[model samples]
Target: MLRIRGTIGDLPVDLTLELDDGDWARLGSQLQPAPMADAPAAAVAPVKQRDDLWQSAQDLLRNAGQLSGLELLDQLEGLAGDASAAKRLLVRLRHSPKVNVASGGDTPLYSWISD
Candidate 1:
């Protein structure tokens, strides 16, 4: 069973879905991965651990003193290789005890909350 409730623009939307055994099997089959050969083989680099991302984000904020969210996102994108990953990093930093956020014109400013 799944319940989805949200707003689309100003309109509210709600939905509920229940899947039986056959439905579950069909969904599972659709989610199966392609054969290995059909996939492109790229060199796999070491994954960046969460600790490293957190430390790097902290270092950036500490060194900058303060940065607008856009500026921080840009820097994080350079480090994380994509906007999505950078957004995740920004959210993590926003919740950290060592960081503080304040509105700065169009964008919020992030600063390191030092001990």
Candidate 2:
């Protein structure tokens, strides 16, 4: 048996799960690591800088399809290194014809507009 309790934003979450011996054995088999010879080497991630913020922002929306304004801003902040820069990126995205913004509850959702 396993138990978990956590919070997502203001919402509370509690969960309890029970597993029989057979279930545990099946799960253990699936969890086994692959042999090194069969595994592919991991590629290195490129370091992003402030100058790449524009392209990064575009790529983010392109891949995600849609993201809430707050979520977009949060990701921009990580790429831009500051809230101000993130705001600037937001404005650019708002003005770009390639992107569209729609109201989503408390925040707006930004989406890529494919032509």
Candidate 3:
């Protein structure tokens, strides 16, 4: 049995899955690492786009020096063109070594850390 509990955007998700022996085997096989030689060339585009967005997000904070969580999220949503993507970028920023997260009353304050 597998349980997944999380939220997608404003939606809450609570999911459970039950698998038998055969299903487990199949899932395990699918989870195996693929060979580098078999990797799809077309998959690079999305990865490149994601990297660009990540860089852009970092730049946004660096330029601002500091911003409230809500302010940052709003700008990131505009930059990423999607709320979910923006939230994901924000989370990544929150955990980054170059950023500092501090509690600020009702929201967090994100500040860029200079090296």
- Model 2, 1-115: lDDT tens digits are 9789999999999989999999999999999997866755442123244447688889988988989999999998888889998999999999999999999999999999985
TM-score of 3: 0.66
List the RMSD of every prediction in angstroms. Answer: 10.8, 16.1, 10.9
Which candidate number maximizes TM-score? Answer: 3
Rank list by TM-score: 3, 1, 2
Residue-level lDDT of model 3, residues 13-107, one tens digit each, is: 99999999999999999999998678898777799899999999999999999999999999999999999999999999999999999999999
Model 3 alpha-carbon drift over 4 Å, by segment? 1-41
Q: What are the lDDT figures for the candidates, one per model?
A: 0.87, 0.87, 0.97
Worst 10 residues of 3 by lDDT: 36-45
In candidate 3, position 109 carries an lDDT of: 100
**Tens-place lDDT digits, model 1, residues 49-106:** 6568778888999999999999999999998888898999999989989989998999
Clashing residue pair totals per candidate (backbone < 3 A): 0, 0, 0
Candidate 1 colliding pairs: none
